[model samples]
Target: MQVEVISSVNEACSGKLQHRTAIVVDVLRATTTIATALAAGASCVIPAETVQDAKQLTKEGDLAGGDRFCRQISGFSYGNSPGQYRGKQIEGKRIILTTSNGTRALCKAMRADHIIAASLLNAEACAQLAWELRRDVVILCAGSRDSFALEDGLCAGLLVHCLRQHDRSGMLQVDDFGSAMEALYRNKANVIMETLAQSQTGKKLLRLGQREDIVSCSQINVLQAVPYLNGGSLIQRLPGTIAQTAAPLC
Candidate 1:
């Protein structure tokens, strides 16, 4: 199997992800928040490309959550922080989420055979699922403001590393950018939290008094909840929940 890493959402095109398993990473908060919300027992997450779209998608029982420039959208139920979703309030409720970069990246990956919301929190589970699906993979980093974000790149690198670990044949081919990301992961694996704290986005979060969020998103392989896109919603699944045999998109 082959794996390609997209540096940022702006660099991702649907054509590259056709018939492939796409793993969208936004570790600074978006994908991490999705996985956290699912692990916390939310029913499903619907990613929207815009705040207007997110508002429109919300029904009476649904919750609208998103952020712009790292601040909560006015009048939304919640912001993009994972901590906000870690409670009983989200149980059995649908989250209509839109973000500046992450949700846009998810929508950009809609052409893939399977789309999985990924972050450092669930990298191992996502790799295992992608390996089982037996499709070439594309890891799209939801960078901040159309530019590459260090935290997202680190998570993509972690995904690349995890995917290679599951390659039984040892023939997994990774693109040049993916290889570079793998190197980045190896070099900073020991100081992940520190690295995140030093990143540009990290500094911004700190200025906004969100240091806890950076700590939460930097943990590697801490969660098994994989947010698999089923139609317009992302439903939670575990590593072994999917059949090993290749199946059509549900």
Candidate 2:
């Protein structure tokens, strides 16, 4: 298995993701929010690239969510907070989500054979699924403001580390950037929360009074549910579920 890591959403190219498993990481919020929503029993999360698209996608019962400049869009139901998605109100509801960077990364990875939404919360599960897919991997980090965010890079590194662990045959080949991320993850493994709290996006969230989001997004491997793109929506696939049986659990 070959693993390559893109530094940020801006660095992702559809050509590079073709026929590969693309894991999108936005640990500070976006991907983490998706995973939390799915785990909390939301039907599906439809990622939109723009606020207009998100609004257009929403139906009567659908919830609109997103963030702009690190703040929730005025008319949206929620912002880019994992804790907000975990609410009981979101149960069995469809969410039209648009984030500053995360959803854009997902859109960029649409050309891949499999698109997996991942974060530090579910890195191991995402890595296992990517391994089972039997394809080369591309990890796209949904960095903040078109630049690499340490939190996203840390999640990418964690995924790389998990992938390496899964492929015990020593056949896993990671690109230079992936290797660097893996090193970063290893170095910060013991201080995951602290690392996130100190990241660029993390500090921004703090300034925005979203420290809970940082705390929620920092829990490594606490969630067994993996969120992967199915058509235009993201749904959960549990650890042992076969691909054929993977359906929306909303």
Tens digits of per-residue lDDT for model 2 on 145-208? 9999999999999998888888767998889999999999999999999999899888888998
Candidate 2: residue 190 Cα off by (Å):
1.0
- State the lDDT of candidate 1 residue by residue for 131-246, as single tens digits: 88888999999998899999988988988999888877777999999999999999999999999999889999999999999989988899987999999899998877666467
Q: Lowest-lDDT window of 10 residues in candidate 2? A: 241-250
Best by lDDT: 1
Q: Could you tell me how far off, in angstroms, the CA of residue 195 lies in candidate 2 after the best superposition?
A: 1.0
How many Å off is the CA of 98 in candidate 1?
A: 0.7
Q: lDDT at 132 for candidate 2?
A: 75
